[model samples]
Target: MIRTSAAALAFLVAALPATAGERMNLGIGTIFDNDAMGDGDDRWRSGSFAISHFRGPEWRGKLPEAPGSFIEWRFRSEIITPENVSGTAITSDRRYVGVLSAGLHTHFQRNGAEVSLGADIVAIGPQTGLDDFQDAVHDLIGTSEPRSAVNQIGNDIVPTVTLEVGRELALAGNGHVRFRPFVEAQAGIETLVRIGGDFTFGGTGMGAFRMRDVVTGQRIDGVIGTADTGLSFLVGGDIAYVADSFYLPSRLGFDLTETRNRLRAGLQYDGEIASVFYGVTWLGEEFEAQPESQVVGTIAINLNF
Candidate 1:
């Protein structure tokens, strides 16, 4: 996968046009989240690849071009390894998932300043290993019990809207630096199937294992019923150091989530034709019972036309 991305970057750089009007920066990057630490089990080895494209009007000789409009599209995927059965020490296999998204960005400027507003649509592809997990849970819970747990893992289509407001800071050098601190809230619904019909086993002597549908599959709904909402806040800055030949750029950002916090920093060498970046990510908090923190490495290449 890494090699293919590199080749694509080279093709894009070589194909860019010489005329200069509205310039666009297209990037391809990968992010790997290794074995989650807090979660004692090593069932999930997750990674994501993003193909991003951003474009805006030129500002060279123009009056710094107040603020133009831009758009971006991103596609990401994640995979999880199988988990160990509750009572049995046997570990389940692995699973894979893919998500695709496209967003629109609009930048508005007044007095030497810029603010951006963006929205996106996200779609989830088919997932694997969910049925096996459900079956395993059912076998553990037995049919004679009154309550059973159902695992609802399937494909979904979601539309999310985001609003971002940010400003640009003029640097002493020839180039300018832009800082954007934004808050994004996303909410959606999907269908879900419960394995074992809401039953607890072994510890509390609850009797009768019944697998009942809280929500029927016949209902015109996607698996894993919607109603899933996530809120994220990010503060970051992008610096562009313009030189006679090219621009040296860097970005640093921090993201806070309900389960984990992430710190990301990367540097990009932007030439007239293409750009490349190397980044490191540190994950804080234990997903399970482990003591050590998780770390991830990333690389990206961008081509402009």
Candidate 2:
């Protein structure tokens, strides 16, 4: 589904005067999260993997307003299971759900604010093959089998649209500290409005375009940075009011928790040849019957050779 025709490729190459095929790759980022990395529990929000790519003609260390200055493609896979995957009987827990999403987003600047707009096709249920994937992984590790896959969420494909607007504030003159405040809106698989802000204490991603993860809300690099190498720390949080969710349908006797909250902190270490990022996030309850909140960890590594 993600194929580029020869004519289209030629058109894009010809459009960029100096960068025909020289500076195509902007950056790539991947995040893997599991409960084993945080809180020591693997109940709700079991695990997820996401990757994103930012590509364009060339990045000039600034967000351009041109229509196609930069393009972002993201893919994600996730699995949600009951509290006990091996249990034979259905407990009063969240139902099993598998999700795979792919989307394309465009980034630009408007009125001194960074603007991101995109749409995704979200597929949910056993069709995503996440149940089988998890089964294989657990079997290899001698973990309990997710028997509840037989009753996982029904199959459905939903189209979701997301939009975010944010502006960075330079708190220190030397670009050592910066703050970004943003507002976001989404409609589709989950309908909600969110407001949040992020703070940076170093120069890890000074001039790079970053993409926010859906589950953890961590900023992963999309466009590689060309700034100084060092260590940087980040802290951010957000609150949202959700109106609907396809994962936990009301028709299935699940009660939705309208207000959702998340808190996260991360650090980045940039070296001459590679960079590493690790972050932990506290995910608030999503349903009324949900137990206490849970913490999840995210990690990413990028190497330049």
Candidate 3:
């Protein structure tokens, strides 16, 4: 996975302990849509990775202000070559799927509102040399859906767990403009419940909650050595209502038909060393022999030294 995320970003810049208001960054991304530019069987091609950690405010009197404690890491890939999903693939899915994640947050202040608490972990599978080159392209085009190979499920290791809560609004008071709203729930093997919101203009305040910049603003006001070179932009969106999604196609077994609203929209740019984002997703209609309706396109870039 890119040499294990470049050796975990050089071991977190060598055992994390550099503080002039520490806040590091690195990101990358891409995604495709239109059923992967039209080749059917719903396709996808994605690549992403990110790493960010912040703990500024000069450790707030030895760590206590909690303005959203942070730690993050991510990786993703959903490539299905042949230049975009096709070329005689005998069903039951999984050509290339990979995901790895880690997220954590913590912010404080109750009665006066400004709360946050979070957790995350996700790991999907498939990537053994692209599943052995897609089993040699399905053994050189040799099978025809043995009922989807006796109903799929086995890209190995699927894990999930998430929990969330957030609220941080700063409408207008020199903090520029801000709003962060959230609600979340998740479970192993894949289950869900989600609610979201985001709106930011300027810097600071974006305590991660799906409207993703993958969380920034020094990871929600942890405050780094005063510097953001000004200029900023953001707009966020989300809407999800999924019941289960164990890699679709009727939980990988077939018998299609499973979709319960999922949408997203985004645009962002945070400067002072590059940060950019663009997202778009719409999915609803996952089967019944594939009834269309699915779109995705995500883009990201971040670099801050």
Candidate 4:
């Protein structure tokens, strides 16, 4: 997975249900670039699948002060190709890497704001099948050269924690037109201090605003942003500053340092039984000597019960 800033992490944590909420949500999203449209690099791709289980009355009874809470678990996967992306040889740095990760989180909401915390663990290397899968996919399409998987991280395990603070804003509203804006800031072992916001329109569900807090994963609250089961549409943009990341490539036998900015734009629609979200993001160069930054497109779908 890409290393991002604190603002991204904060936004993600704020979007989830706070440990004792009323509903559950299941969703999947892909973070990629316009390579699918033949307009951008195809080297970096990532996806996330997640589900939120309601905290329920039994759990709320034990913690009455925070009745709307839930446990969220997510599956994360990613593939990186520095050489292919930059179109240059990379020495010492990893050439490619495939990663699979999972995390368990709990969140709470109160007075139009939310607090969240969670932990995730990562596994990297060939066993992850990210590189081979990409190779097979590209072979089917007949690309120039197949990409090699990176082994620098070497089957290591990385554990990180998540924390965030978020606020929901109701700027204006009417039967047909409504506006809501929000802001959040948070820190993760992966992202030091990320901050971002969103402005939403159309309906009054979580689906009415930007649904993703992170480029690759959906936040617990954003997942329920439209939990009321209504027809809604949303459009929004976000920006963030990331301090450092263990996920990005490093050199000199040390983890690389980063403090770049990230920007994203997205649109979404929430319906009665299912919803869809499409978004795109630009990441600042991960390494100083790198040629250019990265652009990725993401799509998310959910089944509501």
lDDT (0 to 1) per candidate? 0.31, 0.79, 0.43, 0.50
What are the TM-scores, per candidate, against the unseen true structure? 0.45, 0.89, 0.28, 0.70
lDDT tens digits by residue: candidate 4, 1-305: 33433333455456554543444343333333343422266654333333333232332211222522444555666666654542454563445666777665565566656555666666677778666777777679877544345343456556666666566565656433443334444443356565555445545454322234454333212333434554444444444455555555343443443455565556556665556666666666555555666666665665433
Error of 4 at 65 (Å): 5.9
Report the Cα lDDT for residue 199, model 4: 49
Estimate the Cα RMSD of every predicted model relative to the unseen true structure: 21.0, 4.2, 16.8, 6.8
Q: Which scores better on lDDT, 2 or 3? A: 2
Candidate 4 lDDT:
0.50
Off by over 4 Å in 2: 1-23, 88-91, 272-274, 303-305
Backbone clashes per model, in order? 35, 0, 2, 29
Ranking of models by TM-score = 2, 4, 1, 3
Which one wins by TM-score: 2 or 3?
Answer: 2
The candidate that wins on lDDT is 2
True-vs-predicted CA distance for residue 15, candidate 2, Å: 15
Judge candidate 4 at residue 219 and give its lDDT.
26
